[model samples]
Target: MADVLSILIGLMFTCTGCLLLFGSSISADVDDQLTQDFKRFITVMPLREMFPWRITSMNYRTMAGVLQLSSALLLLLTSGVLSTIANMVLMVVMGVAMYSHWAVGDEINKLVPALICFSLLMIRLFLHLRHMPKDKKD
Candidate 1:
């Protein structure tokens, strides 16, 4: 069960990374829809006033999105020493992405995706941390 659980988690991170990566190449309308969808989620509503924003105003978020997606792909395919290093790099990229979203006026109302991404990064960090050597007492 433990082995299966570990595999599931790893697969999920990889799959999620891939999923977000794929979102990058879509059209501007599609990207706008995705951002609005994210906003709707953070507001916790089946229905709400339509979001009053354009994804175009924040081009950096899209760049961040690609970075995150690529990082996720790297984390999924990579293994051994390279895998660990890649996963750490992925986390850092995603962290920058999360920051980019917040830096813009995307609003806390659009924060669900950011939080979800952060959670994934944290999991990757935990997995990598467990594989690291403990510090020695001086």
Candidate 2:
């Protein structure tokens, strides 16, 4: 069950990362949508106000995509501690996504996907920790 869940999460993140990183090359429509989304993200993202320097949305998108892709790869290719760490990283990313949507007053529909992914990551992490071996001190 844990293995299946990990694979599902890995595939989901991989597709999401690819969409963020390469959707512009896939189709004009996709590119337009990504552009619009990036604009909205820049306008509403709280960090923009907190930071002094100008940060382009493209750079932010690229960073997000890289983080998701790297974490997903780790989850897919490794096991035990590495997989657990990947799951935790993904959970943090999803949490930030959900928070961003809420902070911007996005509709519930826009927030649901992140909520679902966060839930799944929590469940997978729980399963991993539950099955981990405990040290027996003599």
For each candidate, the alpha-carbon lDDT, in order, equals 0.53, 0.87
Candidate No. with top lDDT: 2
What is the per-residue lDDT of model 1 for residues 1-138, given as tens digits with 9 covering 90 to 100?
322333444565555444444555645676676666455334432122464543332333344455555554555565556655655665665555455556555677565665665676567567666776788999
For model 2, the stretches where C-alpha displacement exceeds 4 angstroms are 46-53
User: Candidate 1, residue 100: CA error in Å?
Assistant: 2.2
Steric clash pairs (candidate 1): none
Q: Model 2 residue 35 lDDT?
A: 72
Ten-residue stretch with the least lDDT total in model 2: 38-47
Q: How do the residues 42-130 of candidate 2 rate in per-residue lDDT, one tens digit apiece?
A: 66665676778887888777877888999999989999989998899999889878887887788999999999999999999998889
CA lDDT, candidate 1, residue 125: 60
